[model samples]
Target: MASFRKRGCTCEKKKCTCGAKWEYRIKYVDRQTGKTKEKSKGGFTSKKEAQLAAAEEELKINQFGFAENGNEVVLNYFSEWLEVFKKPNVKPITYSVQERNVRLNILPRWGKYRLKDITRTEYQKWINELRDHYSEGTVRRIHSIFSSAIHDAVHEFHIIRENPIQKIKIPKDVENTNRVQYFSKEQLEKFLNSLKTPQKNAKYKHSIQYYVLFSLMARTGIRIGEALALTWDDFNEKEKSISITKTLVYPLNSTPYISTPKSLKSVRIVKLDEQTVKLLKKHKINQNEVILRYKNYKASKDNVMFHQHDGRWLRTNVVREYFKEVCKRTDLPVLSPHALRHSHAVHLLEAGANIKYVSERLGHASTKVTADTYLHITEKIENEALELYSQYIKF
Candidate 1:
């Protein structure tokens, strides 16, 4: 005989069916694909209610299938997307940078999570955790990679409704600015003076390269990569100009690679001062002497501007370490290779160089960036204004 139980069940455990437990299960053929799918609803007060819930879910699945939830697209899918999307569309160097961010940062965090389920709150929490573990700049770069990946998911996979990162604010820290520690003029002079003395440390012979590199950077405002990429051919001794068409870049765990300049503006020819040209000629002669001493070594015109004793290209990391040692010996502030670039801009502005000319020399996309960044050098503006006022005033 069929029995009807009226008393409701409060049992939450799956196996417990002590009371009038109502469980319903359904199997239906997808209307569009004619595929069999099974789903279940349980612990309802009544069978009819469970049936209704199951029907609604079945309808959603039948209409949208996996698209209804981003769970269907896995981490492997996003990885594939990143590779294909970046290879054809972005420059190799840019793609390499993105690849490192994805592998080292993004994948470890949200790779297993579904795109649709990645909410702003979840991202914010993850970002905060990352901030605690890593530097702000690193976390910011990871955020950019995740944001770009999610954006591509929307456009390519149609899996995400919108990018979750668009609404969330990035973490900020003091190091976000272009400002870097720099040697004072007197300290710089002292450091250069110290370089003239032979060091007790044989490894410190390379210290001279730091002086030349830093001095060039301080005078030219060129990026570290651009400085490393300079070649004998790029320098015109007769014309006193430097053609900046390429830059050196080393991606994480990869060998150094050369790439085009940062932008069209970065490809301009910069005129060198007389003193700068003289220094460059001296450096060139020194470099040529070293190459001649090691004639058996492979040295080609296409090689890097700077090289090690083995005739290998000098790694940026090695340069940075040498810079640190020099700073310590000279009792100067510890400044990064980038600080020289900042000093260059500041000194040029202080010497009454116009923002437009500075922008061109620095290869900035616009003068606005140059003006905004070097606004601290107001002495130039004051001197210019005073000169104009003197011409107009009548006593």
Candidate 2:
């Protein structure tokens, strides 16, 4: 496996630390390049350390059929790995994000360090520096990319024995700093009523279709993407349930495409209130009239519930921009369209819907996620519970 022997040096030279030292050497064949080379290490204080190092190296070589690039600089190696290994295996959206992080953030900062030389302390300092400048979520994402790269180096390339990125202590407060806002019942009614009755000067273009689109998200807590992916086929009129099996994703410069909902639970059936069902009925009749202009496009074939009046898929930004205008007109706090889903969760949970059912309605993979996200509502519910308990205390 590995060879270890005593290496002799002339003690006559004043610069020499010792007359002899432990030496280890091995021959390793390159798996990808198809070449063989001698790998050697020297200058250990004891033979045991030298032998152990050599043994580890030998094991790495044997397992992977090549010598680990432990000596390679971190940047050059990871850049190549990202392009060659990671990009092809992951989805386009994932590849685009990871590639940007690697190229711009990770490599720019740690590209010079050698793989084996990156210590836990060194990474901790780097992370601390990152925390001061970037948001907590961005810093965590960069750390995840670095950790995944090191994990691959260990399992696939046998380059490092451990992942230094994982050992860094993460700041707890640095998680999810996104500003979340939702409407109270009065505010929601005001906003939706503003959409239906536009002021004379503003001339809001909201129709039955936009009204149904926004109402459905508030009613069912479905993501905008999931709502956009719906078709006439997905709605069960008799059962009054909507099938949420797919989502629409539109990346820039690419044709719009339908993909499965984010998780298995995302593909579910959600019952609709009668008012919402009636709204859909009126919207469907209006949509049928609009689709007649597009001779080549089948509205049902396109599988879009809220297809644009011009027979095109509605991009995410289009809906967001329209909602922004509606917010300005309504004299309401400006919130993204996704806030409707959050409002839905908060409203459902406050009305004493079971937590598990709310989780399923939101298509969250777990109730824990639902509980954590709508924690404000849970706190209110806790206070209400205490009031109910007080009724029994007057014995």
Candidate 3:
């Protein structure tokens, strides 16, 4: 309900000659916070005008749950939206990624600005600024998170009329495209061999588990997280396959936990080669001997295939550091553990495997995604296909 009053007049005592404008104040309970808030406008010429304006205000409140008043800060609204919508819907790791980017990128710049005041020109400028400091991929993700929140504000909350960040183009990355993200077959073989062959006078010895882990990743192209989440039950010896149902979500700053795979397709089964199966079988026997050697040692209750000596999920950071060291020792290009996945994809394509088969084997969402990611990496395969096409054509 709204109350109308005359302002700039001494009407409480008696009617005066001074002119005053009519005002109407509507009080509404905010559904998001469960608190009453007031919306008022003054300077109307008459009480009838005030009442008509108040009706519009009341309609917006009733329809949209609250009237924005165009003064709400972006940071406050985004925080509320993140909690109410995104937190429950996304995975913990995904939520953390969104929250971290919002804190580090979005809030630092536009948090103080009112949602109604942010124009498209300003948003595009901010996106360009972000592109200057971060990789195109990183900026794209940050932009996506921010734009998604804005979209929900317009469509779901009616806080804004439209999203200003729509149709914004992400700037190209400045980083070198030629920087190696994966390895050739020979380099992959060398890296794996370094893991298996014992190093003399080494500060720390490489274990058989590390060898099997890399071997599995190279052979099957499973994610590092999926490989870490593997347990004895996930493997089938007779079938020569591994079920990729879950993945490890190990944040660098927090304790590790098991989560579902990256997507629905990521939960599919991955067939293993004979050599990888033999490596895993050998690793299991070695793990059993190690367990017997230490009576007080506590093995991970889940029986994870690759774990710390005390039987805990291995940290990806630690694995990555060791992987880099192995690369340095063997004179190979140091790349992240994910490179094994890329190498596996490239190897399959080079061996004349069907694109659809490789896509399914790698658990990609589609063959297009597979081709887009690995097509550039398979230059040799492309040349060979071109050669074959030229030979067959006669015109």
Q: By the TM-score metric, which is better: model 2 or model 3?
A: 3
| Candidate 2 residue lDDT tens string, 107-200 | 8877887788888888888888888888777888988888888888887786777776676776645444433579988888887776666456
Sort by TM-score, top down from the best: 3, 2, 1
lDDT of 3 at 257: 96
TM-score of every prediction relative to native? 0.74, 0.76, 0.82
Distance (Å) between predicted and true CA of 317, model 1?
Answer: 1.4
Model 3 lDDT tens row, 1-395: 99999987766656545678999998888765577888789999888999999998788677556337555677777787778679999999999999999988999999988888888898899898887788888998998998998887788777878888789988885565533388898899889887777678743343477888988999889999999999999999999999999999998598899999987888898888898889889988888876766665557777889888778998989988988999898998878899999889888888889889999988899988887787575666778888999999956
Tens-digit lDDT track for model 1 on 37-66? 555556667666666666666565543344
Clashing pairs in 3: none
List candidate 3 segments past 4 Å from native. 1-26, 29-67, 174-180, 199-206, 294-297, 377-383, 392-395
**After aligning candidate 3 to the native by TM-score, how far in Å is the CA of 158 from where it should be?**
1.0
Better of 1 and 2 by TM-score: 2
Which pairs clash (backbone N, Cα, C closer than 3 Å) in model 1? none
Candidate 3 similarity to native, TM-score: 0.82
Candidate 1 global lDDT: 0.71
Model 1 poorest 10 in a row by lDDT: 1-10
